[model samples]
Target: MNEVLIITGACGVGKTATARVWAKAKQGVAIETDYFTEWIYDDSLERFTREEEKLVANLSLVTAKEYLAQKMPVAIEGVWSPYGLSLLHSGLKKKAKNAKLKFVWLYCEISENHRRDELRVSENQMKQRVDIVSQQLQSYHWENYVHHIDTTYLTLPETLAAIESK
Candidate 1:
């Protein structure tokens, strides 16, 4: 059966990279919600407002539903909380009820996140905003449903193995 994998985490936790790699390996489609949000606000908007996040989330869900309709597996990568993912989960159930849905959360130590953030080259203002948001969203709690991966000390191969083991 086709599946929908929602990959979420704080900023700099490698959600996009991991999702892309996984999708390619599995011959699935990867949707980066940040790309959708960027297309919506490609101007001087330095940060995503809650309203913008909701809009992008909706668009991402729509895209995922479309892919699943085509009998294709999909991976959605984003910095999403449980609340945000709950929205996607409900939408997917309503739109593609038969698709298996999985929620994966990638986590790493604050120091590692900060290091990755510093290594990223982006506008200084954007970097600052991402830093603030990442710090605020460093921890997440969901009861028994989330596939949590602590990527603090894992190499790329190790991380992939951990995710695939799930």
Candidate 2:
């Protein structure tokens, strides 16, 4: 089976940090999903249609397939909703015929106050992202999956170790 790792959580929850360590320790490539949109959209003014978002999402899956073809473990880290993961899970299932694909969700419980303080992105950026995410969450069902790691109090290393255990 092909091995696929997904490291996900809310903003400022250290998902990226844990993913980096897990990828390096496991000798897998770490792909940041956020970069896909950032790279494709040079200007925020140019709004992405729903079709465009799906297209970019497909591109990410295609890239993941390419990595899986190399038979190397791969880590995908970012703020992914259930819909996003559904797309990714389907893509991997289709592409990885003889490989194992694993999905691990890093469920972070970041307090509103802490999120405001510990965020690495600027205040404006955080607000913008959270706003969009808030809107998206209204229609998302977040309880379908059972595999998750609660990262409310764990440090980065602890979180990485927890995910690595299973």
Candidate 3:
């Protein structure tokens, strides 16, 4: 059976990079929600609203299901809220009923987040997003069903190991 993996985190938390490597390792496909959001926003908006996030979540989950139905393992990366994740979890199970579904939220220290954001390419760099997303994640109450990984001190491989274990 195929698998649906949701690799989520605040901006600059390496969600996209991790999903790419994970997809390669598992011989699956990786979908980045940012690209979808970019398209919806016409690539002009620096940040998206909650309503927009909901749209992106639905769109990405539907896309993931399409791939999973074909026996292709899928990894979707984004910054989704608890409500959004809950919906995605259910949506992924639709087409791939027998597939394994997992959600991993990667996070790091505020300073580390800032540093990482700066290290990213100028075009994709997100300065305020790092802090804004981090704060939102902290204030929100996430469901215990999801795996929360603090990647402040972990390397990419180590982070991947933790996610796999979860």
Candidate 3 residue lDDT tens string, 68-116: 7677889999888887788787777675678888888898999999998
* lDDT assessment of candidate 2: 0.64
lDDT per residue for candidate 1 within 72-140, as digits (tens), equals 889999877667777787888898888888888888877787777787776523455455556556545
CA RMSD per model (angstroms): 3.0, 3.7, 2.2
RMSD of 3: 2.2
Instruction: Return the clash pairs for model 3, or none.
Output: none
Against the true structure, candidate 2 reaches a TM-score of 0.74
TM-score of each: 0.83, 0.74, 0.90
lDDT of each: 0.77, 0.64, 0.82
In candidate 3, stretches whose alpha carbon ends up further than 4 angstroms from where it belongs are 39-47
lDDT tens string, model 2, 10-127?
Answer: 5555667777777788777778877866654443533345565566568777877888778767778766666667777777777776656656665543354257435565532554
- How many pairs of residues in model 3 come into backbone collision? 0
Residue 34: error of model 2 in Å?
Answer: 1.3
lDDT, ranked from best to worst: 3, 1, 2
